[model samples]
Target: MGKSTGFMEYKRVDENSGAVKDRIKNFNEFHKHLNEDDRIKQAARCMDCGVPMCQAAIRLKGMVTGCPLHNLIPEWNDEIYQGHYEHALSRLLKTSNFPEFTGRVCPALCEKACICGTVEDAVTIHNNELFLIEKGFEEGYMKPRIPAIRSGKKVAVVGSGPSGLAVADQLNRRGHSVTVYERDDRIGGLLMYGIPNMKLQKEVIIRRQKLMEAEGVVFRTSVDVGVDIKAADLLKEYDAVVLSCGAKNPRPLAAADMKNTKGIYYAVDFLKSTTKAIIASGALLQDKVTLTNAKEGSYISAKDKNVVIVGGGDTGNDCVGTCIRHGASSVTQIEMMPCPPVERSASNPWPEWPKVLKTDYGQEEAIGVYGHDPRIYETTVKEVISKNGKILAVKTVKVKFDNGKLVEVPGTESTLKCDLLLIAAGFIGCQEYVAKDFGVALSKRNTVATSDPDVYTTGVKKVFTAGDMHRGQSLVVWAIAEGRACAKQVDEYLMGYSNM
Candidate 1:
């Protein structure tokens, strides 16, 4: 918008990573930001297309085409290009409750729909967004915005994950007294632990938490609803209750029944333990040390162990990186699905989520360290080999689709030495106990079932569900969107109208 031919004049520039050798020594973030002028040039590349598909959240073949939040992309790009940094940040914050989180982790659905990418590289929208937000923070433009008035209504948000935080933030700003409950010792549910410090630093989540607290949102940690506090009690105290509890029920591994195995863990549990250890040790945070390392004896350390990850999605990739940082002897990731194409297929054209290969930071670091990619496609564990209740190895076999069913090949079984096995298979749905305790129904897929298809209300009165609890496992961006939408519904239900 700033320059008519800027797309042709400037090449797409992205953040560079610290060298693998230096970065793997610790779990700090490796990506470095571009300078201000370069980021402005990147923003200038926005074409200001008439349709602006980058902001259009169209669904094609069950895949999202653009940003689900419908971010004002071109508008903010113009603001950045015009040297209005605060204006750019304001436009960004209008649509996204947490640009810093989405900017770091989202797959950039907006960039894939950019008109410039039809032939050449798309504008560096994601990088530009990060630059704007981080610059806002550096310039002290981001501050606590305490509401001027109170509506005299209170809301209890269960879970301190992205969706719950979004709900609390929105409702607090709307003048409602909001309280967030988290089961973990820390506030951020998944962000604090599920994601490693390398991808999203723990301090970033804490910084936002402090800001939210200053703005009048109360945070309660180590308080598990239905256990530490009764679910019925929250309904009696608050005008409304919002369930942003994530999908915590992990899909069980086929070898889960091997109770005698010594070194098996779920991916989320493993990642959470590492963070808790890091926190307890005060290794990263500049605080007085408490425990030497993760709550003593709670963690299954990958140090000097041959680790095998059972899934090949993002969680599995995270395991690969974490094990590498732990100095694992060797690591391997297994995926049952065939490897995706290196480029988009004919049927999977532009605007649809690109079904192409993505070599994330973890995979890249694994290649740098191990001298080869660690992923094994079309393969799955056949049996967990153990001796004296200790894991020793794993037998795997190649699989293929036969009449819409996956069947293992007859003679492709093989074994890999596995000292530690981490199952990164994705979650199934929300934990049933929370929904059952609240007397809310669940859909056939096990996600929370709403009383009405058009609303977020659960079968239980005054109880609402959002985020992964309602939609199943999804991106942080979607969780934020769902939370905002659910908040509007709750506000309307309480006040008979909503201006959110």
Candidate 2:
């Protein structure tokens, strides 16, 4: 509901990013926001399409193409265009608990499904969201809102990830006491460590954590529920229990020798180490942490090393960027799937998740530094050649999908010198330990089982599950949506009614 002809009159403008040559020298956020006036103009590009597909969250050909949280994109855009920022913030918060997180990290499904994109560029919905949330914080409207009354019912949330945090936030706002348990030393499970600092600054999470604490949510970090604390204790103490621990079980590389390789690491582990080292050294407060000035043994550094990354997803791109920032000598990414088309093909049309090549910031940095793209498609690691238990090189082979089955091509095997190998091949499912301890059944896909797909309650009494743990690995927006829905179910179970 922006201007009647706004979509036709205005063009989309995105936030500026730091130059690759300059930004690769440090571990810091690179994107700079547009000024208020320019941001408003961008919002004006939202068209009153009558049937706004941007927030539809529809599934077409097995791929979801809109905001999972179903954010009120058009309404907020109208408010932003009219400079009613407070109204925009209210509408935004009604659906999304953390615009700041999604705005920065989400792949922008809304933009992909935007009506404006059919004819021209899509509206800058993601940037506008970040602008709104940041403005709320800057103007002091994001202060803690203590509940007027307490329901006196306690809910124990395991995880403190986006899903867990959303569950805790919604339940706490409904006057129920919520305590989030995290296994790590800090809160914000994935946001804290799984992601690299440059993509999402840790201080942003810390700021939200502080505000949540002020709003009466209790957080206990470094407390692994299954091992450190028994499930029985939590069941007895809380009125309801919601498990939101994410699917962190990374898929292992097929290379047998990789198990004993010293220089091999999971993508998340590599990212976490770098983030921890950055925080430990207080690099964010001081100058940037570069290869030379970084503390020794603080992280798995890639400086002057030949790096090879497995997988071609977002996590793999992140590994590429991190390696570049670590001053890698050379970088290579091996992808099992064939390369996608540069532009949308006839078979894949608009309003479907575009199956096109996306060169993320990581690949961009790699190209700028290496003078060529690092991705090697239709290829996979055939063997890990190690020397004295340390990785030395990788033997790779080109592959093709024949009758929907992957088959390696003959005589295409090649060897490359590799010092460090990072696996970002995605996750198989949720880890089994927590589900086993809770006595909850798991689906065939390795997610928590319920009576129905939409249900969140587990077979165990007073217990429920949400997020990646319940639905397998998914986006942060989906996790937040699942958390909110699960919280409503918990509220109804506790009081026999829920208006959440």
Candidate 3:
């Protein structure tokens, strides 16, 4: 601990963010870093307790708490408090492969499980982490670590998302030749498109990609394994293959005539198209400008239209932000479940992933522009009102749970003007084409199925899987953890021993 009594002396100080009104004008990161002095004070708040739950990845009451990567939170907090910037960064990188990515986007499970937060505000673990990694880059400490000798083994990573990137980074550093294949025109699979540019800038992903390339990881964009490149060909050429394809099979809406409606789109498609347009524009995105449409031959635009997004999770929140940035006249988000309590419920005690209501940046921006939170809790889409095959409005109904079944309440039906409807109801599983092509069996959850009692390996030899493809839809931090563990197993299979 930097100072034993520092937790008592200093209070938590979060990183400052730009006002929502000013931030919504452009699609860029708006959260500003804390000054060095204040960052130190925030880090000093870490008590370095003997039982530091911040880094303890534990499962309780069916919910995961703390950092899944099991990061050395106390060690790094002390390093930051003592002004040992490089040491702090080293300690951070020991567990996380992409602290920069997690820093910007992760929900910060570490803070939720923090012992300090049990009584008071938690230490600024997430902000301190962002500061350390960015400091590493600024001070030129983050450089390519090319392997000195070749291991004479080759590995193919069948995705460019977080998990695939982690596998490639780890395997390449271990002297194995690794090549990452992505179907999209650019790398950083979900990171590049699924997430909006306002939350995580495209340049950050590209910067890391360039560094990975410099370190001798080959990236093949627009190459879809099992389609553009045959799965059999990969197995014949490389010693091993790791499938990290994310779970992108979107859950369908049961709205009447939803399929034929011209203004309907998946939440991923909407968010992806907006990011692509923003990146292609080379500046802040403008209203009604079309880049590559999410669906072939169909353009998605929300400018001056009343948009209704289905789902109240992060993806829907992203859609809310994107449509607002596109100048949508009005926006509303619908959730099937009841709104969570403002604070943690008695059933959800400390260190069990606090189930509290959070006003995210998108909600804040929506409230600033529309003068109210756009979410309609305990409600769901009932139908898609359309005319001439175009969406004109959305019908919704309030719902309640009875006998563990969702039942729509009577006399609570309403309709809202909706020129655009985005389905953000979450993913069901991985797309079927790739899994079928690879001859991999699937579990009941529609995820890639491995041999009995053995994960990461398919029934077919020399084939492995990770990330959402293996574990179903999960957090990016979990994807990286899965990738690291899968890489270690793959290394052991190849060399009969491993140190990845």
Candidate 4:
């Protein structure tokens, strides 16, 4: 705890973002960091409750709260308040593999579960976290902590996303020789290509990857384990293999098939192409793609075109923001769920994550540029109207929950002119072919199944699972947790004990 009266004295201040009009010109990170003094003040606002819920990471009444990685929130907050930033970073790195990613992208369950938030605004834990990591970088205190000696045990990590990275980091620290293999050309998985650069700059990921490489973790890219290198090859060479490939199986806007529209594209496909183009150009992305780009709209820009994004999740909002930066004539996002109340409802008490309407950074940008919010709640895209090969417009209908099911309201159909459609619906599970090819068991949810009877093992001998590949699509924090825990299991399998 910093000061008993700190929460009362401080008023929450949001960090600054670039002017909407200016940011829309290109897909770049727009938020400016809070100054040191203000960051410390924000840290001081942590009430340090008797039982701090901020880092509890729980699902209460179907709502999650606090840091899912179970970060030592109050301790770090105290360190930050006392100007012990390096101490705070140490405590933060103890559990979370990447605070920078969470600080920028997470919904901040910790803030919602804040004790002070019962009556006042929650402390800016997320911003303070960003401050700590960036401070570590600037202060030159962030460096590789190589193990004193290698354990002579070899471990293989499949996937290179947050989970696999966390597992590799932990296992490497425990003195095990580790290699992380990624199917993509880059190492950061979703951080590398799935998300837009405007939200998470690629250099941020590269910084960490470089540090990890210096720490003795080998990274191999563009190597598909099931294809380029056989799974049996890893089994023969390594003591254990941990799978962290994220759930890439996108939940179809199965509705997307209804459109039969040629210009329609998946959100990930478009965003990946956009980021690839940006990475290649080293500045604002180009207006076109080379012949090899695999995504729709790789050949075109959203400029001067009306766009309708289906699915009001983060992906949808990202699409809206990207299209805006690309100079979309107008943008709208539709969701099946009804709008949530602004305040916590009675069913949601203190420490429970309030189900509320949150207009994220993207929506804010859209509003600033368009004069109104772009999201339409309680709505669903009904159909897509297209010319011979291009999207023409989108048809939508108002919907409501009736007896636990979505019911379309009568006579609520409406149409809007549209030239492009991006589906931002969430994913369902991991891809099946590779898992099936290895004869790995799958969960009822279609994720790689792990049973205690197998000691956290997959169907194939010496095979293990973690992250989205093991647990389905989830937050980065949870994926990190899974990877960390799974590495411990693998270490134990290899050496009969795990120091993790």
Best by lDDT: 2
Clash list (residue pairs), candidate 3: none
**Cα lDDT of model 4 by residue, 283-304, tens digit:** 5334422223324444346779
lDDT score, candidate 4 = 0.82
Encode model 3's per-residue lDDT on 1-500: one tens digit a residue. Answer: 65688888988877667788777776778888888998898889898589989899899988889999999999999999999999999999999999989998899999999988988898889989999999999999898999999899999999999999999999999999999999999998788899888788877898899999999999999998888999999999999999999998989998846567788889899888777766656554444232333343333678899999988988899999888887899999999988899998889999899888988888888999999999999998888888899989888999999999999999999989999898999898898888898899998888999764237888888999999989888889999999998999899999999976
C-alpha-based local distance difference test score of model 1: 0.88
lDDT per residue (tens digit) for residues 306-380 in model 2: 999999999999999999988899999999998999989999999999999999999999999999999999999
lDDT of each: 0.88, 0.91, 0.88, 0.82
In the predicted model 4, the residue pairs found to clash are none
lDDT of 2 at 71: 95
Global Cα lDDT for candidate 2: 0.91
Q: Rank order by lDDT, top first? A: 2, 1, 3, 4
Give TM-scores for every candidate, taking all chains together and pairing residue i with residue i. 0.97, 0.98, 0.96, 0.94
lDDT of 1 by residue, 1-500 (tens): 75678888998888899899888888788888888898889998999678999989888898887898999999999999999999889999998999889888888989989989997899888888888888988999999999999999999999999999999999999999999999889987888889988888888898899899999999999998989898889999999999999998888888654477888889999999888888767767754222245565766589899999999988999999999988898999999999999988999998887899888888898999999999999999999999888899999999999999999999999999999999999999998887888999899889999865447898788999999999999988889999999999989988889999
Best by TM-score: 2
Candidate 3: where are CA atoms >4 Å away? 256-258, 284-299, 451-454
CA lDDT, candidate 1, residue 286: 53
**Candidate 2 Cα outliers beyond 4 Å, as residue runs:** 287-294
Weakest lDDT window of 10 consecutive positions for candidate 4: 285-294
Candidate 1, TM-score vs. the true structure? 0.97
